[model samples]
Target: MQTSTMRKARYLLLAFSSVILTTGLGGCSVSSILKKGQAEQKISVVPQVLEVNGENVLFEVKAQIPKELIQKKPVYSIDLVYNYGPKMVEPIGKMRFSTGEFIYENDKPTITRQYSFKYTPEKSRGKLLATPHVAKVNKAGKRGKTTEIASGVITTSKLVVKSNTVSLAPDDYRKGVSEPQTLTFFFDEGQAKLRDYLGTNMGVLKELIESNYKTTLVEITAGHSPEDADSKEFRLPLRRAQALEKYYKHELDVKSYTNSSKSVKFRVMPVVRNWDRFLKQVQLSALSPDQINEILTIVNSNVSFKEKERQLAKLDSYEYLQLYVYPTLRYADVRITYEIPQKKDSEIYLLSKKIVENRIDSDKLTEEELRYSATLTPLLSEKLKIYQAAAENTMKWQAFNNLGVTYIQLAQQALKPEIREKLLKEAIINLTYASHRNPTAQLFYNLGSAHHIQGNYLEALRSYDYAIKLGGRVEMLQQVFADKAALEIEIGQLDDAVTSLAYAAPGYQTLMNKALLYTLKGNYQDSKTFYEEALALKPNDALAHYCLAVIAARTNQENDLALHLRKATQLEKNLTAKAIDDPEFRAYVKTPVFREAVK
Candidate 1:
C-alpha cells in the first residue's frame, strides 16, 4: 500500500513541476509584435491590482521589463519612490510594470490582463521626479515606524535630519511642524543695560539642556546691536547673535553645538540680518506676560504662525523677528534672557531667575548715564546698585532723591579742606530741593547724612531728629542714634558718651573708638570693658591688642601692662608712634616700658 501511494505521489509531483515550468515559461515568453511598422511588445505583471478605474487600472507593480531587455527574464526589481509631501513620502516596495493592450496579427495568440492602483489627492509628481507605482504600504505611519509609503518621485534636494524637512515646492506651502520660538529682552534704551527679560530666557534654555544637553544637541546664541538716528552701524543681526553667545558663555556656560552630533552639527547661523532696522523698530520696553501673550497670540494667529514651519522660501530674507510690547517704566531697566521656542513656561521660568540674578544700572556707572550697568553680582551690590539710576523723562520723586544723594557724596569726596564748607552748601542746594519735591523719610535721612558729613554738628542733629519723626525704620533710627552718640563724645559728655556708646556700640564701626574716648576722660574701667568687647569681635586683630596694651599702661598695672605692651609692639611696628601721638596714651608716656615699646 505504501509503495502504491508513493508511486502515485511522484507522478503527481512531476505533473505539478511541468505545470510550474509552463506557467513560468509563459510569463517570460516575449516576442516583438511589430507589423506594418507598428512596433509593440507584450509586458507581464504579478496580477496585483492597487487601484481600479474602469480601463485605467494601476498595479502593485512586481517589475518593469524594458523593450527587448537583454538577459530579459527578470534580473532585479526597484522599490517605488514617491512623496505626497516631505513627511508624507517614502519607499513602498518592489513593483512590476505592465504594457497597455495592443493589437496583434490575426494568426497570433491572444492574452489579456488588468491592474488597479491606489492613490491619495497629494500629487505623485514631486518638485523633482516621479515614479509610476510602489509596493503597497498598507499602513502609512511615521518614517522607520512603518512600511515606506512610496510614490513615483526622485529628488536631489537633501536636508539635515534633525532640522525640519522643508518642501522646495510648487507654492512653498506650509506644514507647520516646527513652531516659531520667542525670547524677550528688555533694553534700557541707549544704555546697554541688561535685564531679566533676556536672563530669564537663558535659564529656560539651561533647564532644557539639563534634561539632556549632550543628547538634545541644544545650543543658545545671541546677537545684539543698536540703531540710533545718529549712527551708521547697521549690523544688528550679527551683533544680536554675538551678544547671545557672550551671555551664554559668561552667564550660562552653554557650549556651541559640535559636529559630533548630527542633530546639532550645524552651528546656529546667527547673522546680521538688519540689526539697525530691528533696533530702530523695537520699543524700549520690558515685555510683560500679558502683553507678550497678546503680541504672540496676534503674531501666531497669522498664516505662518498657525503653521509651525521653516520654509525654504524664507531664504529670500523677507522675514523679520517678531517682538511684542509690554509696559515700560520711566527709565526702563534693561535685561536679556533666552527662550526655548514654543514653550511658554520656559519663558516664565527664565524671567523669575533673571529677577533673582540681575539688576539694571550699576554704581560703577557714571552719574550722568541714562542706564545702569549690570553684573554677576552679590547681595550688597544689589542694594547699592540703583543709587545712580537715571531719568528717562523724569519721575519727580526718584529723581529728587537721586540728586540729593549725589550732591552729598560729591561734598564728602571734595579733598580740599578749605572748600569742604562750599561742598556742604552745594549739597544743601540739592537736599532742600528734594525736601520740596515729594519728600519721604529716605529723603530726610539722606539730608541728615549730608549734614553730618559736612561737619555741621547741630544741623546734623536736627536733621537726624527730623528723619526719625518722618517714619524711618529701626535700622535707620539706630543709625541716627549712633551718630548722635559720636557728637556727645566730641563735646566731652563722658558719662553721656558712655551711655550712648553702650547702646550704639553694636551699630557703630568699632568699640575701640569709643573705648579711646573713655580713656581720654580718665575712665580706665569703662575703657577696659569696651576694649574687651572689641577684642571679642576681632580676636586675631592686631589693632585690638595695641589698643588693649595702651589701656593696661594707664592704670598702674606696669607688670601686667608690660606684657600687653610687648605684644602690641610685636604686632605692629608702628604701635609706639601711634601711642605717643594719641591723647589717650599720655598717662603711659612716663613708663619706661611704654617708651621701650615705642622704640
Candidate 2:
C-alpha cells in the first residue's frame, strides 16, 4: 500500500511539468534566446581580385561590420590564407583589427587589407587565391583564436615569367685584340723640352691612335729623378708635364682629341727615384743579402719621406745607385688607350684595298677599320701590300712589325720550300728593323715565333724570355707562356715545358695542353681530370673532346671512348684521321664502335 502511494505522487509531478511546457516564458526557450542574440550580431567579408600595374597581382579584402554589431561593441580580427602557385598554399601574413581602429560612419565600421606574391610576365604559370577569416574578441580584451566565419577566394591570377638565353664563344673567335704600348721621353738636367728620340716614339704613338676605332685617352705623365733638389722635384715634373701638354695642344695641333671630349689628359706624377730599380741593382751588385736588408730597413722606416731620402743618400752604396737608377727616372711616359672593334671579312677586304690604293677617306675610315684591314685581310699578299704602304708613309715601328707578320703568314701558307724560305728571311729582316724602331714585347714575341719556325731553338727561347719580361701590356702574358712551352717541348725539355706553362692562363686551351702533357707522362688519371676541367670551361672544345677520347681509350673505357670519339670527329672532321693514328687509341683501333666512330 505504501509503494502504490509513492507512484501516485510521481505522476502528479510529471503532469505539472507538462503544463509548464505548454505554457510560455514569453513563448521562448533558452536555445531560442541564444539564437536570437546571434542573429542580432552581424559581421561579413567583402572580397576582390585586382591587378596592380601590368605585372603584379594583388589580393584586396575588406571586413564589414553593421551598425547592430558596432552598437554591440564587439572587437574582431581579419586573417587571410593564400595560394602562390598551383601546388603552393600558405597563410597570408597575419592581420588583426579592432572596431576602434576602423573608420566609423554612422556607427558602422569598415576595414581593409592587401597581400601580394610576385610578378611573372612571360607565361601564365601560377595561381593565387586569398581567403579571409574573421574572429571575434571576448570581453577579456584578447582575440578569440578560432575562425568563426570565412570569405570565398578573394583573388586568383596566373603568373607569366620570361626565360633568358645565354651564349658562349671560344676565345679563338675573339677579334680585335687590344695591346698597350709605352712611349718614354728622356730629358736633360733642368730641361723640360722634347728630345730627338721623341720624334720616333711620337710617330709610333700617332700611328697607334690612327689605327684604333676610338682613341679613348692619352695619359701623359711626367716625373723627375730623386737626384733633383727637394723643392725642384715636384716643380720639375709639373713643368715637364705642362710643357708636354702645351706641345700637344699648340705645337702638335691635335684639336680633335683635345677639343672632342678632353681625351688628352696631362698629369704630373710625384718625383720617382726608381727606388725599386735601385733595390734590384743592389741585389745584382756585390752587396751581401744582410747589407741589402739593412738598406731596405732604413729606407722603409716610418720616418718622413724626406728623412728616408736622407737616409738613402747617406748609404755607402749610394754611388752605385746613382749610376744605375737615377738616369732612367727623368722621363715622361705616354699611355695610349683605345678600342678596336671587330669587322667583317668583306669590310676588311674593302678597307684593305682602299688603304693600299691610298683612297681611304679620313672622315669615313674608322681606326678599327684601318687596323683590321691592315692586319686581318685574308690574302697575305694584300696584307703585305697594305702594310708596305703604311710603313712607307708612317715609318713607324708598328708598320714594320705588321709587314713582318704578313710575311710570316705568307711563309706559313706557302707550299714551295724555296718561296717559304724567302718569305721567312724577309720576315726576319723586317722584324729586325721593327726591333730597332721599338723594342716592344710584341715585336720580340713575333720574332720568337719566326725564329722558332726557322729551327733556331736557342734564339727562339731567348726571344721568348725577353718577350715575357716585356709582356705587361695586356692578357697576352698567358699566350706568351703557352708559346714558350710549345718551344720548350720542341727542344725535348719536357720538364721545362711543364714549368713554362705554370703561369699559363686558366683557359680551355691551356688546360687541354696540360691534359696532353700529363698523358705523355703516363698519368692517365690526372690527364682525365684536367681534360674534364677543360671541357667544363668550354663545352664545345673539339680538341678537349678528342683528348678525352684518347684517354678513355687508354683506360679501356669502351663506352666513353666511343662516345667522345664520335663527338670529337663530329665536331671536327679532321680529327677522324688523328683518332685513327693516335697511339693512345691503338687498343681501340680494332673495336667495331671505334672504327665506326672515326668513319
What are the Cα lDDT values of the candidates?
0.39, 0.57
lDDT of 1 by residue, 1-599 (tens): 99999999999999988886544433232222112101222223432212222112244332223333222233212334444576765443433332332223353322333333333223324221123221222422112111222223211000000100111001111122232223333333333334444122343333333422233223333333222311223343334444554554443334434212344321343322223223222222122234334434433444542232233123222121221111111011112222222223343333323433444322222221211211122332331233223222222334345545544445456688667677567656556445434333345556666665655556655665554333334444445546556655543344655554443426223376576676665677887787778767766655656656656755667765666666667777776655564434556677787777666
Compare the candidates by lDDT and give the number of the best one. Answer: 2
What TM-score does prediction 2 earn? Answer: 0.42
**Residue 493 CA displacement from its true place in model 1, Å:** 3.8
lDDT of 2 by residue, 176-262 (tens): 665544576657766777664511255554455444335555567776655645225557777776666666555334434333334
Q: Considering summed lDDT, which 10 consecutive residues are worst modelled in model 2?
A: 160-169
Give the deviation of candidate 2 from the true structure as CA RMSD: 31.3
> For model 1, what is the alpha-carbon lDDT of residue 344?
35
TM-scores across all candidates? Answer: 0.32, 0.42
lDDT of 1: 0.39
